[model samples]
Target: MPRRSYDHYCAVSRALDVVGDRWSLLVVRELCSGPRRYSDLFADLPGISTDMLAARLKDLERDGILTRRKVGPRAGTAVYELTADGAALRPVLDSLSTWGTSQLGERRATDAVRAHWFALPLGRAIAQRIPAGTATVHIGDSAFHYVITEAGITHHDGPAATPDLELRFDLSTATEVATGVRSLADAIERTAPQVSAP
Candidate 1:
């Protein structure tokens, strides 16, 4: 299929021309963490059809937003990763995440939840206090870690090998922190949540 565009000269329109689509920014969101295998992106997105994912990826790759590469020590597989231009979308994601927090009041019957899904908000929240370093968030059977640097934040699917700090909490508490309703400190004080430093 041919690509769609705003077909205008305005700056905002030009920016949107690259990222404006139903699942486009979200795909950028997934890649914000780092490189992801095609299967991983499909799985985490939830509800996105395979064809839709493929097409969006193609568009993104064509636009210089992301690149497809063969990864692994051996028996390599394909992974999609953000380009420098794509990584530049970090602030955009952060802004959107902050704005979207208010709308995240409740999870619907069809809503999907994953620890890493809250990475953006939590990473922002963590950045406020720590500013820099790595944090591993362990929630139930799942986990995610993020490294905050001078540039911006990038998350990983699982725990950091040597995290500066670790936060272990359940799902509800994770939601509370992510939504800005309750802070990690407040949650720790109230529930005696596990917080470790190494």
Candidate 2:
């Protein structure tokens, strides 16, 4: 089936033609951490149906945004990873995240939350302070880490094996930090979060 398009000769329109579908960008967000099995993607995306998820994956793959490959000891496992083109969307995601922060007024009863979902915004906040280093952040029962360098910041799904700094905070504080309502420095100063060098 052919994709619907604005048929305009505009870069933004072309880009949207590829990723404007529902769940596409969110799928890209999940893969931003790293490659993930189909099951992992399905689990993280709360409301998407299995058929919809498969269709989106196929579309993204067809568009050269991602690729599925076999990995593991015997190469029996398959995982989906972003291609170079897909990884290029990181900045786009960052921009959208920044713009959407003020729109996140309050958590609703029906809203689903994930700890790693805070990684990007918190990473941006942390980079302003630390600038460069490995920091493992613990938000409630979930753990994620950020690696900041002269180049840029990249976040991962799990804790660093040896982090230069360790931060512990509750989900509320994390949400505040991610949404830009509270600064990480303020959170540290207020002692709502415990930060230490390890």
Candidate 3:
């Protein structure tokens, strides 16, 4: 099947033409952390059907946004990772996360929550204070780490092998910090989060 487009020559429209599908950007968001197997992607994305995930992955690959590669012994397993072009969408996702902060008033009963989902926004919120170090944040059972540098921040799923700092937060506090309702610095000062050097 052919892709539908606004057919406008504008840059935004062109970008949208590639990634404007319902679950495309969210797929990108999941991959932003690191390479993931198809099962990993499906498990994390709560409501998407298997067919839809497969279709989106194919579309993203065709557009040069990501690449699917075989890894491990006998090349039995495949993982999907972002191409450089797709990784460049980090700042774009950051901008949207910032913009959407206002809409995150409270977690609803129907909302699906994943701790790593807060990684990007929390990275942005804490970048200034912990300007150039790796931190592994634990929010309940889920863990993710961020590497901050002069270039920018990049987050990855799971814990860092040797994080300079470790932060532990309850989901509520983490959400508040990520959504800008509460400042990380304030959270630290108030002892709402447990922070340690490791």
Candidate 4:
């Protein structure tokens, strides 16, 4: 089938018109996390000036991608929300994040901080298997240990002394498997994951 062409025949050009410059997608990402007051959004995204943030938001609103609502009961109170169209970009963002993580060669403290926390599928897997124990997960160069007790979940850097199970994987495979982009059964069959029972 022939590709459906835009009027300009330049998808990148059209997308740029909506989210062209810096901070536009980031603002959309922030809104995707949840509804936020303008101040809160500004605070969460570091290094974005108040004026630039406002301008980007205005542009998105103009493009019908975002909508600003008067949140509180009183006057002068407002919050930003992603429209249905805007919210549809979440999968794109998640794929980008997963891809970005896979491409990083030298892991940094921030990457550790980010991937150090479990993705939802991994979290659910760990939570189900070890209701009252700790486990260390090593995926590529990233490592993090989680302690699950009667209290709650506690995270630590690096491997645990002794874990009930050690789940080892390459970063990309692990991410794809965790996010359901790739099947876990397929990974198991393909030996993409090295699972150790302790």
Point to the candidate with the largest lDDT: 3
Which portions of model 3 miss their true places by more than 4 Å?
189-193
Could you arrange the candidates by lDDT from highest to lowest? 3, 2, 1, 4
| Residue lDDT tens for model 2, 1-198 | 897898989999999999999999999999998899999999999999999999999999999999999999999989999999998998899999999888888999999999888888998988888889899899999888988999788888789888887888889988988987888888877764477775
By summed lDDT, the worst window of 10 consecutive residues in model 2 runs over: 189-198
Mind giving the per-residue lDDT tens digits that candidate 1 earns over 61-98?
Answer: 99999999997888489999999999899889888988
lDDT accuracy of residue 85 in candidate 1: 96
- Taken over the whole model, the C-alpha lDDT of each candidate is 0.87, 0.90, 0.91, 0.68
> lDDT (0-100) at residue 32 of candidate 3?
98
Q: Rank order by TM-score, top first?
A: 3, 2, 1, 4
Clashes of each: 0, 0, 0, 0
Clashes of 4: 0
